[model samples]
Target chain A: MTAAPRPAPVAIDDPADPRLAPYTAMRERDLVGRAGRFIVEGEVTLRVMLSARARFGLESVLLAPERLAGLAEALARLPGDVPVYTATKPVMSAITGFPIHRGVLGVGLRGTEAPGAPLPGLPPALAPALVVGLVGLTNHDNVGGLFRNAAAFGADAVLLDAGTCDPLYRKAIRVSAGAALIVPFRQLADADAILAFAARHALEPLALSPGGGETLAALLPPARTLLLLGSEGPGLPPDLMERLRTVRIPMAPEFDSLNVATAGAIALHHLSRSA
Target chain B: MTAAPRPAPVAIDDPADPRLAPYTAMRERDLVGRAGRFIVEGEVTLRVMLSARARFGLESVLLAPERLAGLAEALARLPGDVPVYTATKPVMSAITGFPIHRGVLGVGLRGTEAPGAPLPGLPPALAPALVVGLVGLTNHDNVGGLFRNAAAFGADAVLLDAGTCDPLYRKAIRVSAGAALIVPFRQLADADAILAFAARHALEPLALSPGGGETLAALLPPARTLLLLGSEGPGLPPDLMERLRTVRIPMAPEFDSLNVATAGAIALHHLSRSA
Candidate 1:
């Protein structure tokens, strides 16, 4: 046999190495300033990115030496050649600005495609699909949970309104257990753009509200639907609320609204079942 | 002019003051070693407690002087007389071991009665009701959310399995938006007991599973039902899964599962609609 295949190695002992710039800059919340790429942490999420053939360009995967043992087997399953970087735990922590428990992290380019665009002659079965619009939901975990729900409930796409957090944020990716990598999503400029898209596609916009006009069962329409959800505190903005068909999940008399992500999942499940 | 009836007042500045023991001990997660009474933070949750007529033996309602003004007005609508403590923000923070963002907090007794007992011979129409069972879920937020969903979806009561987290944990109370107080709940010593209770009452045990045997819509019975939910990672224990009637919410092909609380909400909503 030819000499054992050489492992793709890039030793990074210095946390300040210029080659590790992309990884270092992600430590700040203001990651938008450093690069347009999204950070996907943990081995599971990185594995999904490699398998999905998603458009996010891989920069490099960094991990502690021990993590590389497990990652090597996972990498063997992927088709493309990508750079792998290994560092000591201390150096990895210093570069990432935090101790990464998952041992593996990958920096991938953020997809720039606009959400809701026709997928080059989309199939009829995929048409008339259920889509979710997130508004002012800033929590990374909530955003991740929503994506997970959307995927589980058969939502075709997820659209983020201006105020929502980045779905590609590291915490979101980790929280989603990499489901975020498989789901297609894009950010809309504003709520009006979301409504216009819904109107254009003949998708009835159903705003989920605690004080909604009708129970979800009564308000569901037999057409392509868009479920609109708002932030935890100041629910769907008044303007957005006015534009969509309001549907409520009739709750017990005394309880307040469900968590935003939970409400979305419930609505998506109902809508998909009805569809 | 006769002075308006003054609210009960309690003054204590020292963090070690005996009168403020409950409030002080709550700073630690143990909630003063009672492990039952959860701390409810913020004016909103407190307002929920006051309105639900929850049997809260209020040790004290601590608030900053400014925050106290509005709460004073809201408290007027409450049915029982409860002491309202006023303190400086720093003083309150020092006693509670955390910043009181809502500038309000309450020390309330956790309900000890098992939720399974029939509600004092209520009418038949009201008697037959859907209830939620918290099995292995240990997250405080998840427990609170389950209660919130139960209350919202018109569940009769919430039953917590022995392994589940305490619903009265301050975090759970906060996450539930105080729904924890209004929705009646009972903690069981074992899940088997809950299963037996459901069996005796003719309540079918509908276990939620990501890869469940039937859709939630099909699993719901025409009579009283108990929706059983497992924790996030290692879903319903293997033994528990074997015993209950398994059901799943239909999800997108590539997605895994909805968050446990989200799944519960969807199930509750579906069952409520069918009812």
Candidate 2:
């Protein structure tokens, strides 16, 4: 089927326009279970989202009026029901919490699905995909970077533990450079269920530690893998460590460990390529 | 020689005490070119410094009185002339521009040139070592993470090319968890010089790219190798790519590239183990 006709352009001159409420309110909203959405800003992430076919039901596209002419062709290609909101730079900044660096922002509905149904219909061959589990990683920037890396390195999905921060948090979304939306992910239950599920799927679970058995390269698992990582200071809890194979990225004689997200990326990259 | 006696302890009730000047003006003070002067905060990093046998020409050690009482035994063990400044939490925070989460801060002289000197004394069999090159990475956190990873993955040294950020920035030092101090590194003139130096040392230089010729596993050079990394947004520059053997970490379809520091960790982990 041909794509839907482009959305009608809606000009927004006043920053206080009532139609822009949801977009503006996004800045201070709790966002955990909110039906409204977060924004994906800048050209690169915007392009990534469009190409991924993840933005099929866009709520509205906001842009600075002066830059609207530059994005006209791309704007013309979006689905018809998606309204395009044009605002001055100052108004857009006021609506969002920060300066509008990318000149484009896509407001989308928050997505929800049962944690168990991360991927709907993939067969067993794709069954035991590489999933990176994040536990207690509170830094939004780090979480965002991890998602970006996960998307870049091709982790099948990201599973966040109970204490982990919301992936849709504005800072997290911006930090992921919008990759959080594109990457297949779910906020799973606690670490126990995550480990049990991996075990059930025959996915070898490996916990990254500074002082683990074999170096990551030496213990590249034969089956699908789950690279489990924890926050910076207090690494994987001893209880969790008891459930999985502990592996480390070997370092020089003096250094201790890499940053949590960096370590995660390395482990994900290794698992992606080896599998 | 017997270790110098630990410096006398001093107590200051006021945040504005003149003796607390260096600690207070740390961020505002330009640190480059200063000999034997650097800041270390937090217990873990402080422990790392103490254990590394880093020269203890410490200018001052600032601690909250509560922390001081707990660490008094350890403080008593320090060598001569190392001054300890005790203050209340507010005074400590006021002096350092933030709460001292580690509850301890040490201003020590930056070590002189002994560590950075060429390893000319080693036998021919051990002449060459693995060196990791970082190019155009300006983020302090990234730089800090790179150093920490470099040290963990047994990289002998980190070579910084022009356009890179200072590895000694305060944020970098803290983020590195203080491994930045322990890892032997030097800033180089240009990428060309680094390439030439690697060639001279019989070190194989592998430039990382998202779509390089071979997977990192297949293309890692012999034991003596150098892994080159670029900034997060752009991979290696075209000229540097032309000068070195290129390799890629095979990633999943639709993913872009891993973060520069994460990529470095993976490469270092892979190459070091195989070597």
Candidate 3:
């Protein structure tokens, strides 16, 4: 395939320049809304963002000169209109309000057509699939980790309920190894909506709980299935569990539970491969 | 079991009381050193420390009055010689130099008979077991999460090379859901010793790597197996991987890698159960 023409690097000298708004004091700004745009940091995550052009719109990029050479190939794939800014280490740090150790950053727009919609639909190859639905998962690390596990196990998609943290949160993106950029995911209004979606698609919705109906090892994943998880403390809500089948990962009685992310990994591995 | 006589709670009003040394500026002190002792925070971890009476000696405990009732059972198990300090929330926070929302804390001594030795050996029920050996794993969260996973899957023990962080770090203990206290683990001076010990126990040593010799899903775990892991970035040192059988969890090519702890969880699940 012919490479898309690369955009020349635009020099950014001023930290307060309007063009650098998206990258300004990113950690604090991340707490506020980002509209439809999100900051993608690190060379690895930037490449993932650029590659999944259909899922994420490459709005712009700010990079230290040295990082350009390493990302040269991925840069070539960027659309000509996408602006690429280069700055020295100090200047880049000033722009981002933190040391840009990896020296690469990009602004990406979610693929959802409208505000609050789910991500781009899954590909046909993932038609008959296993998906993970997350409910009330506010921890960014866990959100990123579950995406990484979902990607590793070849799960079709991740469905996030309203209470889940943004997958594009800077720390989450880095922790997911950029799987949050590559994986198909959509944020639903609530846990019930995710269950409804699962039903409409002929997928069996399985909620994970410590007191689940069947041990994970003993159950067979249906042709199309959605494994649901909740935050560790409260776990899946009783009402939600009552509406769907529940599965538990057998554990030693002495321990209370595994980290939510670890539990997701084990269950994903079991359903995606073993079952 | 008959309850042992309970120690009367000593009231400590001053955070600077010398008796509160172990709880003083705990986060900072944790970095400097705690001699052979470590801070065990949260009620659950305190319970584990008390239950592990033989492995961990309770030096003293500082608790908020409200937490006393919840911990009464575990507290009863503590020896009469162990000091139990009761304090108000403000006094407790002052002593720890942080908010003590869990309102329970204990200081536990490492059980190794000598410096730099392995942890207490595994119990007989864990014979013919699956274990995890870690090298260069310095992240406290990952270390703790691995212990949690090991506990969930009933892995016999965790062995850490000297480069690995102490699993008893307060954050690690909390993150492990107290598994760090219950799970048997020991620090070896280097990778060579860990490999040697696995051999002495007739365990088939398998190092995990992205470029492993075999896919984890394709392998059958031996009667006794030791899964070796390295830090996420550098992964296992090449020489170490060269010396042992290596395995990789199959994943989508587009994604980078899973969190080291998540990777460990998947591998441990595969070895201990699926295989």
Candidate topping DockQ: 1
* Cand. 2 TM to true fold: 0.84
The parts of candidate 1 lying over 4 Å away from their true place are A1-11, A25-27, A30-33, A53-55, A77-81, A114-126, A219-221, A239-243, B1-4, B7-12, B25-27, B77-82, B111-126
lDDT of 2 by residue, A140-219 (tens): 87899899888877676777888888777767777776777776666667888778767676667888888677777766
Q: Tens digits of per-residue lDDT for model 1 on A1-275? A: 64445467687899999878778855674456445677878777888877743546677788888887777766665444567888888898888788866668777876455554663211244356687888889898889988888778667778788899888888888877777776777778888887887777667788898878888766545468878888888988887687667888776665557778888877777788865
lDDT of 2 at A236: 82
Candidate 3: give the clashing pairs: none
Q: What does candidate 3's lDDT look like per residue over A155-230, in tens digits?
A: 8789999899999898898888788887788888999899888867777888888889998877877767888999
Model 3 interface DockQ: 0.69
Sort every candidate by TM-score, greatest first: 1, 3, 2
lDDT of 3 by residue, B1-275 (tens): 97577768998898889998878888798898888889988777877787852357888998988888888877887888889999998998988888878778888887557664444655333367787999999999999999988888888889899999989888998888888887788788888999998877777899988889998878888778889999999999998888789998877665547789888988887787743
Question: Where is model 1 chain A poorest over a 10-residue stretch in terms of lDDT?
Answer: A119-128
lDDT score, candidate 1, position B262: 80
TM-score of each: 0.87, 0.84, 0.86
lDDT (tens digit, per residue) of candidate 2 on B85-197: 88877778888776655668887676556655674222244455678888888888789888888778767778788778877666787777777776767778878877876
- 1 or 2, greater by TM-score: 1
* Candidates sorted on lDDT, descending: 3, 1, 2
Give the clashing pairs for model 1: A152-B251, A152-B252, A154-B252, A251-B152, A252-B152, B38-B168
**In order, what lDDT does every prediction score?**
0.75, 0.72, 0.83
